[model samples]
Target: MIDEHRQDLAAEYALDALDPESARAFEAMLANDAELKALADDLRETAAALALDAPAHLPPPELRERILSRIRAEAEAGAPAAPTATAVAPSTEAPVPSGGGRNLLPWALAAGFAITTAALWMERGSLQQDRTALLQEARELRNRDFLAKVKIATLSAQVDAYSKATAVIVWDAEKQHGVVKLNNVPPAGAGKDYQLWVIDPKYPAPVNGGLVPVNAEGIARVSFSPDQPISKADKFAISLEPAGGVPKATGPIVLLGGN
Candidate 1:
């Protein structure tokens, strides 16, 4: 457990408010004491997080005009007033710098202006980062929205051999990918496996869309990527081909569905 004194030192150190002598002493101790170092690190992280929580405030809209007006007033006031009607004896004391008040006021005002400008620049940079993050998020959302609007086509048995079988193709045209869901599908013949195909007008022949593997329950949901890019999926079909499948469909069409 850390003592309150140590915790206080850590907090001051984290805020960078510790005197140089004390800070050096604390750092030396921190290097030797793991527990104290951990406490200091935690304080630093908390301080950084608190900084982010600070609300952003811009300088008042009228601040610039007010400063300019003050400068003009100071300049006018610095001018020697019309000579007094009655003259006085010259002072024996050494003269003060001419327009000392006027000079100090401008320097003060310039420092203030510089601080405000720096703050404004920092705020602008933070806003730009936020805008960039929002744009990236919007782009991701659009891509997801486009992907969600997939084309769903239902595949039915093409012949009495698979009259009881049913499948559905959920195709994403944008990604050129799709998944085939089957129900009540029977096992393929010995030495033969089921294959998937995508019929696209862009291709001379049907594009192979991988193979399908049905479980013992006669149901399955398999994902496939077509061998060639498909702009439009005109039709989805399942065929019986040799085991391990073929490059191009070379077997009887068992199930078929059209756009």
Candidate 2:
């Protein structure tokens, strides 16, 4: 039987905070069970409530200004600007002549060599800093791509698992962007319906994305903008409830995905 613990797990999955192995285990169970499906719906509803009630966090004004300035500079330059921080230059040390030949050329060569070494050191430091920044940017891009693929795969799996109808939801991790696609879902009864939920991992609860209806083809797609990145969520789900959803899970889950 699906219990409150499962409901909680489903909620956590929607938020994207579940450890990898646990999420996979939950998905495995979700694949074959109807009761869990209902629980998933309830969790989704709870998530919707959390999304609506949660407070929003805005970036610091100074940080925003800095970002805007950087963007403007890039636009003016028609190219990307160098990173703000760079590596420190290496220290220079005079080298002694090979074989202790006290020759006039040795001292002259040493001075020239020291100057060249200093220049190279400075250049190396700048290059190192640039490399570090580039690496960080690359990592961020990769993470975003990974989350996108995960969302697509999770939705596809949910659709495949349902013997009845199913829906796919999408959200942007950074901007609270969102959309939904439905398949094979039947229309709800009068005074009964399905509602969407967007769960944030950082928050203690879920949030409402919107409501959706099953169509003639048993498919529906809804688009929305969330308050934050969907990728940071534990999971997304749908639920059958009264015409409107409740603040917490009060019914069974319709769909869910996480990790």
Candidate 3:
């Protein structure tokens, strides 16, 4: 029963749209249900990734009226309303042109065509922006990663399910600082988060590194350093943790690397 209720809240929780009470309740449930939590995390991650990948588009200004006028005019003529501008926002620019059911068809078709072209143009512009940003980010990451002196370890996804994902941990032992770059992992679902762990043999349990927030591409750059300096890191791993991260790992290990 609780799991059933949580299913409904999962997406909302991931989106942070749940009310405080609902969120707290969901978190409580997440603590005990590893399978449910893992599912939620995957869903949330995918949703986040999709949102980032999707382009935001606004319709051409005149597309709205051209559509509404045609519909209203059709009704006046006692004819069925024609299909409208599919991509347009609500029409606030102009009202239906006067003159009952007259020669508005041609103008409407032209306006619809113009709007479609304009939407494509806008989408192209958005895609260009995305490309520019991606290129710049890639350049910066390459320069910093390759040129800067650092220690790096390659991490492998733990299971076949995550074969597409990749991870690398870079650290400056002298500075006692590190960064984890995880790429191509599907986004964590709502109310679920990916977390990093530093496994030291001396310790009874793996020390929590922290929650990792990933982008739409499932790319996450997590900057972290352990609370206490260590002689050496035996290994590192990433797990699908509850949202905001748990004090200790209580979920499946998704990625792993040895020192």
On residues 81-152, what C-alpha lDDT tens digit does candidate 2 reach at each position?
A: 555878966658766564535654786587557545654564565556666886676546544553453243
Candidate that would win on lDDT: 1
Provide the global lDDT of candidate 2 against the true structure: 0.58
Q: By TM-score, highest first, what's the ranking? A: 1, 3, 2
Query: TM-score of every model?
Result: 0.44, 0.39, 0.42
Q: In angstroms, give how far residue 24 of model 1 lies from its true place.
A: 73
Off by over 4 Å in 2: 1-150, 153-162, 227-231
Candidate 1 backbone collisions, by pair: none
**Alpha-carbon deviation at 224 in model 2, angstroms:** 2.1
Against the true structure, candidate 3 has what lDDT? 0.67
lDDT of each: 0.72, 0.58, 0.67
Location of the lowest summed lDDT over 10 successive residues in candidate 2:
150-159
Error of 1 at 148 (Å): 8.8
- Residue 132 Cα positional deviation in candidate 2, in Å, after optimal superposition: 32
Best candidate, TM-score: 1
lDDT of 3 by residue, 1-259 (tens): 2233455466456545567897898889889987557546744554444334335554566655565565556545874576674675777788676563565887678756866676566566656776788767654554455223334544667777777776666555556667677768987888899998888787888988888899998888767877667556778899998899998899999998754
